[model samples]
Target: MFGRTKTSGKTSTTAAATTDHEVREGAKGRPTPKRREAEQRNRRPLGSPARAAAVRPGASKEEKKAAREAERKVFAEERALQRQALVTGDERYLPVRDKGVAKRFTRDYVDARRNAGELFIPVAMVILLSSLIPVAVVVRASLVALYALVLWVIVDSFLLRRKLNRITVDRFGDKATGCATYGMMRALQIRRTRLPKPQVKRGEFPV
Candidate 1:
């Protein structure tokens, strides 16, 4: 039966809802832990044997082997990242020789053009084979062709150096040291065979 005053008709709704186990509005369901108990729960073993075992001088051979393997794995992963960076032009992993905004611009400039030096290997090979043929006309023709190609390469290299100097000066406000040499070397290589492969396609010269 509802609790009600003898002289009142209204039911005691507050008395009906109240209970011995009722929780307060903002109370946590569980009791708060003591400071000491919290500290104990979070405590960790200091200088624990298991944690120090790997670095100890008297460590086991298995531990040493595991350490070495771990080192090699890290080294291999770094090398793989470096190799990929070379192809992708990732600055973080590129080697000392390949780093720099100026160098990147030089590479793009060289990659955009066709170089006569790229024919040196093939032409030289033909000249060597011609020498073995012992035919006067063949030998003479090959020599002349080789000479022409060499002259062209020299002239092309000179022009490339001059152009690189001008462009670097204009774009960078100062010519980058050794930029011409770096660009010329890269330009001399066959496009596909160049390391840190050409970033730009033919006719895609850097602005």
Candidate 2:
């Protein structure tokens, strides 16, 4: 009985080979019916037509001009109707101008007062000393002081008075006028603000 019996592992391998051969034969005999059905289902629908011709390229020059003229005519007709309606209507809307003259004047007066308070004494001293001193020396000294004073005034105006005026104008002036004026003043102030600084620091150690 032991001599006649085969190994269990050899028997299992033989069985597996037979099963694989049968599967290959089955697959070759009939292409899978389900796979064919799925391919047919995935195909694009034939009902819808292709897209219309690509808008016939760009219009010719004459066609473009004609279209523009047509649009202009329509616009002109609309504008004429609007004008007629406006002319017939009794209610007229006029834009009013701002009345900031009084405010501007008052602000200028105040600024003048402040500037004079700070600057008048030094100016008076310069003038008094210039009269008592030698003419050339006095002129040189006064000119230098006056130049410094002017620079100070310009800086003060831009930083302080101009900014204050812009705020006041926006609050009190007409919207359009105030905005335009403020824009111009702001531009000018910005231009004046970017002055060159002295290169030397006052208390630096020598390299």
Candidate 3:
């Protein structure tokens, strides 16, 4: 009786193992290992190496010029629409202007106009001088002028502005004007020209 019980138990264990193997084989038919790997590859990010290789570079110079011309035409049409809306007081297109905002806008407009007029004559004179002189002479003069301007900008922007800040704090209890002056000095520095320096030879020292 003992041997017969042991043999029946071994046969049942083998049947259970066979049933588990069949379940795994059925799952393979539903979604295979290869299909899962393909799905993962398809979900890869756009900037990944594989995706980057598929993207084309930007257009050529002629194509870029054509695109720019098309954009300019669209901008002209938009400007015309805005102008028409403004003249007709179209509420849908025209935003309501606050009195304080309008005042500030007018002030800025007037200041810009006055500044441009003041600069016009000096700028015209410089352009005329540049046209009359040889390009090499003009370039040398410009480099010298640029060096001087950079030095002046460094001094006035950092030193003079700091002094102005102290004075403004002591007298007015406000530093707004000093800040504006410092900003103007910084703008001048940004607009200044940069000239290339002469390169020295391997065995030579710059004089």
Quick one: best lDDT, which candidate? 1
lDDT against the true structure, per candidate, is: 0.80, 0.46, 0.45
Can you list the residue pairs that collide in candidate 3?
none
| TM-scores for all predictions | 0.65, 0.27, 0.25
Evaluated with TM-score, which candidate comes out highest?
Answer: 1
Residues 35-146, model 2: lDDT tens digits: 7788866655331121111112366666656655666666676656555433332122211221244333332333233432245446757766775677887777777877
Backbone clashes, each candidate: 0, 0, 0
RMSD (Cα, Å) for all candidates, in order, is 17.8, 22.2, 17.7
Off by over 4 Å in 2: 1-113, 116-132, 135-138, 173-207
For model 1, residues 1-207, the per-residue Cα lDDT tens digits are 344464243335555445422655765667899999998777664343443444556779898677667666767887998999988989899888888888899999999888888878887888878877789988888888788889999999999999998887677765477788889998888888887888889999888
State, as a TM-score between 0 and 1, how close model 1 is to the true structure: 0.65
After superposing all C-alphas onto the true structure, candidate 1 shows an RMSD in angstroms of 17.8
TM-score (C-alpha, index-matched) for candidate 3 = 0.25
